[model samples]
Target: MYQGIRIAGFGGQGVISAGILLAQAGVEDKKNASWLPSYGPEMRGGTANCSVVISDGEVYTPIVSAPDTVIIMNEPSLPKFEPLLKKGGLMIINSSLINSRPTRTDITVVCVPCNKIAEELGMDRIANLVALGAFIKKTGAVTLTSVEHAMKKVYKRAKPEMLELNKKALQAGYDAVK
Candidate 1:
């Protein structure tokens, strides 16, 4: 299996971190994966995005010119990345921030109130994980178990409580899809 995914949002939204976690989860699943991040110079509040490629075979390159899935975490990201999704691809939108919907009919769209869900889970920062959870549930690109295991690796400085909170956020997002 192969999935080329792009996750985008303004900085401080954890766009890059989400991509890293996804690639790490792919690694945990024993798959070939790569992650490439890009962000504006302004850092927080600036636009940020990352490309992630996970494959059962070889990962040809890290750059994802056309993604199989695009996770849009903010309003500005929707239009910027929506057109980059390949036909019949999946688009996960953070409905909590984006007020508009995609015009495309060829792709599958799943709208989740990421920020709201995260807030309910006790933190707004984990909204990216919430979107990631929805992505995992919809695409099954990587297992939820693998993602949970990967959290230990990605957030090495995180306390056990924080990790548990993140896991709860993920599970909530996963369950939200259905």
Candidate 2:
């Protein structure tokens, strides 16, 4: 299976980190994966996005012009990437930050109040992980086990407390979608 995922949001929202986690999960599961990230000059508030291609075969490029799945965390990202989502794609929207809904009918839209949910979990910073959890659950591109393993490896340098918090956020997001 080939899954091209684009996760976009403003800077400091963990957009890049989420992409990295996805690619790591794919690699942990023995799949071919690539991640390409880009961001605006402004660090915290500017736009940021990353494309992740996960397949059972070779991936020639990291670019994803038309993603089969998109996770948009802000209003600006919606307008920028919605049009590029492939027909019958999966659009996981952060309803807590994005007020408007997509007008397109061909794609399946799953709205999760990521920020709200994260706030409820006592850490708004983990909102991106929540979105990632939803994406992983909905797409089945990567297993939760793989993501958990990646978290342990990727965040081993992080605060001991944060690693647990992050895992909770991921599980919360996955459960939120169901």
Candidate 3:
């Protein structure tokens, strides 16, 4: 199985981190994976995105021209990446930040109020994780168990409380879509 996923948002939104986690999860599941990140000169609030490719076999290239899935966390990322999605792809959009919706009918769109849901969970910064959770649930490209293991590795140095919070945020996002 091969899945190309793109995660886009403004800087400091954990777009790259989310992509990393996904790739790591793929690795944890013994799948071949690659991650490529891009961003503008401005760090925070600037356009940032990452492409992730996971497959049962080797991934020849990291570039993702047309992704099978895209997680858009902001308004600017919508127009920029929406057109890049493959036909019949899955789009998990953060409706709380992106007011507009995709016009395409060929693809499946799942709108989640990431920021609002994360805020309700008491950590707005985890909005990216929320989107990631939804994406995992919707696509099943990576199992939630694998993501949990990857999260542990990603936050290995962090405090236990923070790790628990992130896990909760992930579960919350997954539940939101279900």
Candidate 4:
């Protein structure tokens, strides 16, 4: 199966961490994976993107020239990546910030009002987790439990208290789509 995926959004939105979580989950499943991000100057505004690859064999390039899946969390991401998504690919969009829709019927798109949903939950920062939850549910790249496990591994050293709140945010995102 096509395993290359790209997640793009604003810098502070957690796209980088989401990419790391995907890579960690792949490692947990014993699959070959790589996570690459664009982090030079356009950190928060100009451009912010991450490429993640998960496969049964070794990965070649970390830069995803064309991705099998695209998770777009802002309006800018759509124009940035719509032309790069492969045919019959999948896209999970954050409906909270973006309004334009992908024109291709060959690709699947799932819109999650992540920021609004998280805001309603009293935590606007968890919007990233909400987007992550929708991405996981839409792609099934890894199980929710696997994502949670990967999350603990991600936050244990840096932000332990964030784990529970992010997990709850993920659950809320799941419920929003369900």
RMSD of each: 1.0, 1.2, 1.1, 1.7
TM per candidate: 0.97, 0.96, 0.96, 0.91
Question: Worst ten-residue run, lDDT, model 4?
Answer: 154-163
Local accuracy by lDDT, each model: 0.94, 0.92, 0.91, 0.84
lDDT value, residue 4 of candidate 3:
96
| lDDT of predicted model 3 | 0.91
Q: TM-score of predicted model 2?
A: 0.96
Task: After the best TM-score superposition of candidate 3, give how far the Cα of residue 149 lies from its true spot, in angstroms.
Answer: 1.0
> Candidate 3 residues 1-178, lDDT tens each?
9999999998999999999999999999999999999876735677799999999988999999999999999898888998999999999999998889998889999999999999998989999989988988898888888988998888789788888888888888899996
lDDT of 2 by residue, 84-155 (tens): 999999999999999999999999999999999899989899999999889988999998889988988777
Report the C-alpha displacement of residue 149, candidate 4, in angstroms. 1.3
Error of 4 at 31 (Å): 1.6
- Number of the top-ranking candidate, with lDDT as the measure: 1
lDDT of 4: 0.84
Supply every candidate's count of residue pairs whose N, Cα or C atoms clash at under 3 angstroms: 0, 0, 0, 0
Order of the predicted models by TM-score, top scorer first = 1, 3, 2, 4
TM for candidate 4 is: 0.91
